[model samples]
Target: MGRKRRLITDSFPKVKRRKGGPGPGKEDGAPEPGLRGEEPCEEILAAHLDETHLEILRQFDLNRHFGPCTGITRLQRWERAEQLGLEPPQEVLKVLWAHPEDPQYQCSLWHLYPI
Candidate 1:
């Protein structure tokens, strides 16, 4: 007789929040980083990301992957931006990293993807 195989989900716990970083949930009104206690002005947002950086963000956002198992390694630059009195760049990169299926991303892969 053949043995029956168990499903992966049956053997493992569902991962919710990322292991190291906090992510939004299935519901709306998720808290914005650094905005829970205060409102961030355009000037503050602009300081960290200028027109050029904004362009980068636009491209990055177009390529993200959503849901669980995603990771973002930006603490170092984020702290630097903060210490210099700047905010971290918006979650555009996260959005792009999540959904690589977008065609726009494929065109940009050569320059953006690591070797």
Candidate 2:
């Protein structure tokens, strides 16, 4: 059998860590860089969310804990609901936005409840 030919390729690109300590779009105790110039959660919810979903969010005190400054992002909410065996209202699931800058609820928060 003939000897197999070898192939040469360029070296892999270097990976550089971000200047920030860790986590995406975060700095020390500062809001995410991408979230800058965005409205607070209250305003966004008030303006776009319907009364039913708003009321449901209120029932869980989600606004208080997960307000614009901090709370659960829409995606996280769905994940949390599944984790807690909760079936969130369809209307609540409909809430969407162009940005992922919304508040994020830590799973730990759900531990406080008896589920």
Candidate 3:
């Protein structure tokens, strides 16, 4: 028990803190990945979705089966909910289909569902 101790600061590498912000990644405005789903585009959803439909999606987002609604498309979430006997609004599926392949609506919840 007579060994010299190494200072905590000397034991770790030093990182210069950026004055503006942490990084260009999250500072630009995006939710912490895996913490929650990317919020659905309300502007787009508003055009097709009513209050009822919006609420349905919100509830599903808060209460999901596999993971945060982040990596999966809204359509996929609706299907999973149906499988679990949770009747999410059908408009979600319809809106997803009607829209022309938005980058937002295309994703995977860490898995390419097997066919």
Candidate 4:
């Protein structure tokens, strides 16, 4: 007769390790890197804006949208403009949104409107 085989069914507990830097409880109390404790500047650049342009900017701020026009894709920019009731020229809007870091988009703006 063949010998009977023994079955193993025991499981080991999992061990958890710390991830990344440190947890909240382990904080050293120094202000985290790149963080400042002062309020940001609130200066408005409305000196050159007419009532209509100012209203548009106010709507943009009321919607909590900031940053370059090109923060979103071209399609998204148009959709957002429509949603916000803004009708600025498409070329002007494109120039405003083009990423400053991208030389190609920046140069394209000059081509669109000669100085």
* Top candidate (lDDT): 3
The whole-model lDDT of each prediction reads: 0.46, 0.49, 0.60, 0.45
Ranking by TM-score: 3, 2, 1, 4
Candidate 4 per-residue C-alpha lDDT over 21-99 given as tens digits, one digit per residue, 9 for 90 to 100: 5665567565654355433333233333333443443344334343334334333454566677766345435443544
Candidate 2 residue lDDT tens string, 1-115: 6997655543566567877476655567676543646777777677664554445544544543333212444556665665676665554455433223433222223444454
Candidate 3 displacement at residue 81 in angstroms: 0.5
- Looking at model 1, the pairs that clash are 63-96, 64-95, 64-96, 64-97, 64-98, 64-99, 65-97, 65-98, 65-99
What is the overall TM-score of model 2 with all chains considered together?
Answer: 0.26
Candidate 1: worst-modelled 10 consecutive residues by lDDT: 66-75
| Model 1 RMSD in angstroms | 19.7
RMSD (Cα, Å) for all candidates, in order, is: 19.7, 17.4, 12.0, 13.6
Tell me the tens digit of each residue's lDDT in model 1 across 49-96: 454544564444344332111133233333344476644455644544
